[model samples]
Target: MTPESAALPGAMHPTDQSTQGCTANGEMILVVEDDVELLELLGTLLKSAGYQVAMAKDGMTALESVTRGGVQPDLILADFNLPGAINGLQMITQLRMALHRSMPAIILTGDISRLTSRDVAFEHCVQLNKPAKLKEVTFVIASLLAQQRNAKNDSERPGQFAPGIARSSIIFVVDRDDLFRHTIRGVLESHGYAVHDYATSEAFLADYAPGPPACLLIDAHLPGMEGVELLHQLRKNGDDLPAVVISGSNEVSIAVDAMKAGASDFIEKPFGRSEMLQSIARALEHSQDANKKLAWMQEATHCIDSLTLRQRQVMDMVLAGFASKHIAAQLGISQRTVENHRAAVMTRTHSKSIPALARVALAADLRV
Candidate 1:
């Protein structure tokens, strides 16, 4: 069909509601999704929030709708995995070129790696890793559109969305046993924790979402990629998402292996609900403590990285208990100059004393 003559499949002409007292300014939003249920849900959500909504099943149709004048979308929310060969990122790029300008977009994907700057750099594009809550989705949409058009700052009208589910923590349960997984999920849900369970490690990995306070429960004897192996792999990939290995066997050796693989805790099967809950609480605490330590180390590393080569040299010598005169003689510079460099290092690192500077180096894992 020709661009102008072709009709969009699921286009809705929502009344252009006033921008006053509302986040939506009656802008058109194109939603490209293959999941029929999700498409309808999003359509309803947007329409209620006072937006002109259009729906396309795939990237090709979405591009056609915009390029053909059937729908002039002000914003686009597309699923990363679509039916055709064209992915969400590629579709966003082509859509921009067709429109003759860049526009704000949100690309929802299960792949965390797609959140890299390179993929989201063309314009005011944002990558929201999947398995995200509906409120998160709406929040991003509202914020991006507001920035794009300088719309009203009113929060999403309170009654426009599903009643907010107050969740304490998110939990992932990976086990080969469907019955057991469901049981655990039910328990977590009853406790007001958002829980998702998978029958395999691969499935869990496929839907892994980063940047959330979450933990994992993995069965030690999983059919493929056993729990300890999964923990090892996650640690190797530098993912510190705390995990607890659940095993049917109670061998000390298995627990030892799990600990070595970076598991925060190990639990034997036939465990009580209280035991499981306690382990999860402890694991979460461990995760929070680790996060604090990591934040401190990141700040330390940033300070150390800001130093010049001379400042770093002086810092190293000073940290190693070398006097200013000794550092000058070794580097063939004046003692006064060495002292000046040391002062700069201390100031740059925000260290008031030599011992404080040494602590920063230790946090950064820098060698003396």
Candidate 2:
């Protein structure tokens, strides 16, 4: 439908009042959903909120209604996994093609893991998880319409930010149990963090990207890839992001493995909010300090290329809790040679002491 033809009168026609109740002239919302109960609930909510409502049971009908019936829906709320051949993303794409422009849309889904192209690119398009409260739905819809109206009035105005805004950070939440995703998201959102919850290692890996949250909270026992493996993957990939492991396990071996794999800290699950927050804060603080130390180490390394490879090896072992005798045995060098290399390394790097050199090595990504 052309823009002019799809624009309906301000109010619902008198004949439509009995089913939807009286509605004021608000934005027109077209809800295309296959679930009957969900559709009716959403329709009633929108109608009560002063919107001129339209409905379609599937993508084909919705497309037909718009292209042939001359119904120009101002905004669309659709399901990601829809019945029949056309899905929500395809429908929106087709609509944009037919209308020669993009229309605002929301994808409602039970599977939050399914992210479409529209969700990633368009700031106007939102994803609302299934079983959304009526008030929550109303708030999101109103917010979008307000944004559109504001843009119309002054295109230069900035868009609305979600409440409790903060800079983006890496958020690693691992829970084999499905419900924790919602709980963790709520907790983080309440504290002004934009949260991304992962159900499994596979999900996290698939969705993984650079520049994630400032912190990670991972469950110790994730499906397929355990927390240790996940941490190893991140470390191997050169992502030194701060991470906290949440585990129900009490085995010291598990904790040791996690630490060896580069986990900043570990905490037992069913932990109180205070414990969780403290762990996260500590990890972030350590990561920040580690980054600074690493920068210094890199500068030092550039100036210390004169040291032999064996001297650097001895330097790493000494700082990693090895005495001269053990360092000699490990590197197959004599104790005297290990001592000489250790002194040469410290001198070359200008490290004041063995402890300082060890810190530098850690920052420099030493393997031992």
Candidate 3:
């Protein structure tokens, strides 16, 4: 069906009005699984939720569907194990490479123990144990789409800063395949992390700007820069980004190399869901620490000259927890003027709130 024909009866065409949700007309989701019954069930559930759905029996077919644009699924739900050469993860690496755009994704599997520590570390991706929970699936799909919409908007408006742990956190998936990328993207977003996906090391390096990424999950066997090389490049560029490497290969040498190149950890493919989550948590924690240090360094580097005398006074007072009105009176200035100075302090310090500014001020050798 043409894009218009795919619209729900009596519903606005996805092409017409972009809705507030991640999907405008309806988000397109590609369901890839060897099991016919599960695929049908997933399709039905997604359609009921107002999503445009497509299906593929295996990894290669899923890639073809994405390539043909028969349905450019905004997300993919894939089975980890598949019939032939390309498994779910392999396919994910492929499709994502073909289409540089990031799509949210989730992996459905029977065994959670199959995944390794490294596979679980990828950000904005999730895996569901077999005999899936429908509610969990529903929530995952909705959450990922919402994150995608927010990420797209944030990327477009680079200067707008939002305050919150969610806003500061980001997940990056460096997989070559599209279906796998989608599956993982679905999983991570479901767990509540903003995700940015790229198919290849080249693509990721070229397009990914330094921002709010909390951690990176990368496939070891990428087209251009292997995970080790990519890890090195990121560090060389002064991006102390934490990463976890997942590989189908079980070579000790490879694992060692990945770690040496800066991967926080390594996992062999076909890993369990629980393992993936645990690994990701570890990497995120590491990334968070690194980011905090970086933020402090940057704040300290800002020139004293950037702030007006009034701004400095306001910042110190705010850090001390004085109310705006109180600061105004103490400074013998109008509350509005004090508020303006407070805003300037935040702008200059890149602080989200008065407390955040105060913490930065305390860390830095503030002139005031």
Candidate 4:
């Protein structure tokens, strides 16, 4: 479908148009598209639907807008085949790194077949085909925004259980082959894991939620979206469920692509049970370690934000490798006072040594 088709009558539902002229409730959206007319149309559409819209013509410009950081978007809509070296996924990845959080996003693509799984493995993201119906676009945006709101509310709720603690032990299997799915399910169930099998990736995605500590075993040659693409979708949805990709071919490139798409491991067909179990164990461990590190970094950032002006100064000097006497001289303070401030910094930040303190500082984005 062409861009002109998108603007035809009956393209947008009556309910969607009813939102026009309403206040946006402070939600902001970033739209990145290279086509000038399409970009304007999207921006106008979003604005009419009660959203504050920001527009960028390419991936580079979108990235620059994010880095400059005045208006942080509540959601992002980016074209997949953006001009320049950085595509939409890369731009979203860069923004996520800078913000240290997963931001919701949607990718619009003209030729969905041209994209590989590696192009979609971004946290809190989904893809939509180009010339997308206005109703479909509005529905996706509303769903993502609603999910974000629910997540925030849950986090802020008092006395909530920590993430992954109450998760079900159900393993998900996605494969086109009936025998393969049956075999895997039987094996996993024998090992004390409840198993759910699906013949298509779309079926699995439709039923997926982020509430389970389960692992995914997916076949590389599914009928619709490939295994790698399924893994990418899982990651983009902010579901950190560990995944293992099973492929009949022993091609190194296929394995590489699977791993690049964020699969925990790639296993060739005819694998032993022991090998599969070990891979699953390792993926779970990796997920645990990643969660721990993210928690520590968030705590450290909070600690850094609580520092006094003098304490922060002392920390900067300490990170710069300055001795106590030198720091005292530089700050026009006594050596004993400098030592006291340093001790307080370490105590408040829970740093055992200078190197540990430096790690906390770096995680908090402090520069010396």
At residue 354, candidate 2 shows an lDDT of: 43
Question: Order of candidates by lDDT, top first?
Answer: 1, 4, 3, 2
Which regions of candidate 3 are displaced past 4 Å?
Answer: 1-25, 114-117, 153-368
Q: What C-alpha lDDT does candidate 4 achieve relative to the native structure? A: 0.70
Which of the two candidates, 1 or 2, achieves a greater TM-score against the reference?
Answer: 1
The prediction achieving the highest TM-score against the true structure is 3
Q: Provide backbone clash counts, one per model.
A: 1, 7, 32, 1
Per residue, candidate 2 scores C-alpha lDDT tens digits across 1-368 of 42112212221111211222222357788898887766776687678667989998999998999999988877788887789998875686567556644457787766655234323222235776655544555566676666666565422111112221234444667677665676566545544566777788888889878674467778878779888898899999998877777676655456555666776666654454434554565566556566754566587556355668787677656655668999888888799988888778888777654433543444455554
In model 4, where is the ten-residue run with the lowest total lDDT? Answer: 154-163
Off by over 4 Å in 4: 1-24, 114-118, 121-124, 152-368
RMSD of 4: 22.0
lDDT of 3 by residue, 1-368 (tens): 53223432321123333233444348888888887766776677678778888999999889888788555778888888888788786677567556744466787766566342235334234776666555556666787788777674522121222223434668789998786788778656645668889999998888777766577889999997888889898988898787888888865456556665766667766664444555666566546667855664565557334787778777767655578899988999999999888777777777653333533454464532
- Per-residue lDDT tens digits for candidate 1, residues 86-138, read 88867876786576445678887776662243345323367776665565666
Models 1 onward score TM values of 0.37, 0.36, 0.42, 0.41
| Candidate with the larger lDDT of 2 and 4 | 4
User: Scored by Cα lDDT, where does model 2 land?
Assistant: 0.64
Q: How close is candidate 3 to the true structure, as a TM-score?
A: 0.42
Candidate 2 accuracy as TM-score: 0.36
